[model samples]
Target chain A: MNKHKQVVLDRNKVLSQIQRLAEVAKTDNWQYEYDAQLDELVYGKDFMPRDSFLFNVNGEINLFISPDSSVSGIHIEYFQANYLAHNQELQPALRAITKKTIKNQRDNEAATALEIELSADAFKSLFSKDQLITVL
Target chain B: MPEQEHILKCRDCEGKLVIFHRHNYDIHKKKHPELEDTAFFPDRVRNALKYPTFTIPGNGNSVTCYYVEEFSINGIIKYTKVVLMNKPYIMANEKIHHIMTAHKVGHVQEEKYPGLKKQMYHNGNKI
Candidate 1:
């Protein structure tokens, strides 16, 4: 068929694989939530084959899956990079600092928690790439 | 047949090395399942962030599973002479390929969803 059609089929195949992988991961508690097509929303119009679906994992991290690997390819960006890079400088949660490091501060603690969980590469990939390809 | 003719002439080209095949893996399955076997992409992207060039299997002869079709486009500029294949590739059957095409289009659907595209591009700081 056409390239677009082929992309759609490929996405489904990837999803099926994800489903299998998720099951294999066997997380004690995991839920899958369907999201509106994000690709069309980005491309401005929808055509044959449809677009990638969205997912909110555990109320955090909106995981996107689609054939437009260009933009969709997860490359983290923004504070995520700084976070991953700077996370090492912070004193361990169980360690002692100047009676007051940013981690000890309530506001900074919350921000640090989120930052700690991400990697430099993944964080950049998430936002830097351009979203390419759109389906019906 | 369609590719054989193309291969014959390229075989005699005196310029750069003429590569006629490729190999890769199944990102989803890990199995390097044999490809259709045929000629594939002309260049390779060695970056981890990049997706990769496809590998369409060869023909009845020494064809490799290296996909050799697919172009790039960005409005005013359209590069059709190039093949959008992948490296360290994976086996994408017709069925799997179809699913992929549809899923990508789904992303296109998102572009039309209200101000979604605007929001995503501007880092959601705008919309």
Candidate 2:
């Protein structure tokens, strides 16, 4: 006869990972910004806590997962020159937003969302990596 | 008591470095308990700014990222500190160069952003 030890799993950790995946999948009402100075793009929902661990998805892209087990945010460094500058459609749209054409902050946010919608292929290229490598 | 304004200055740019109680101090304490020791906290930050191992451009125009490597029982750990040229949260008319936050990035981050590795500098010399 063999005695087996009972195995217990961390429920909260599992739940948070699930929630982060769901949020990433949905991709709705995401607040985004393209910092022209740093040429970085960051977008996410909810507050990103201090305990968030960064998971590198690809060379220039990474995801932030909060301690609560939720996807806090994602950022793409060198957004303009690397990703958007080459593309004809995305280049102009992003330039317009950063150029301060949309004076209102709220309206600017809306414009950014619209630009992202138009450049789905461009943005998707950043997340083309299907495998999530644990860099942390 | 000395005001926060008189406490520190940015090593590279020579600008004043301000740490807010709410955004920086409290938040950092909660997130990075490893750096909670009051004795070495200020010295660590000051030295990090003075002699950073890596200096990456920040995510925003007004921000700058600094990384310093530390040796611990676990091994070489890197701490990242971000400073902003303008504190948007503050309602003050004057621009404030604020120390936003500091946290450990571990060794893995160096592997993740290879481009940043190429730009690493030690004591103002490229390593």
TM-score of each: 0.21, 0.48
Q: Identify the leading candidate in terms of TM-score.
A: 2
What is the per-residue lDDT of model 2 for residues A30-52, given as tens digits with 9 covering 90 to 100?
44556555565655543455556
Q: Point to the candidate with the largest lDDT.
A: 2
Model 2 residue A44 CA deviation (Å) reads 0.8
Lowest-lDDT window of 10 residues in candidate 2 chain A? A1-10
C-alpha positional error of residue B65 in candidate 2 after TM-score superposition, expressed in Å: 5.1
How high is the DockQ of candidate 1? 0.04
Please write out the lDDT profile of model 1 over residues A47-114, one tens digit for every residue.
Answer: 11123333212212323444443112111111222222355643232232112334346535643333
TM-score of chain A of each: 0.20, 0.50
lDDT of 2 at B48: 60
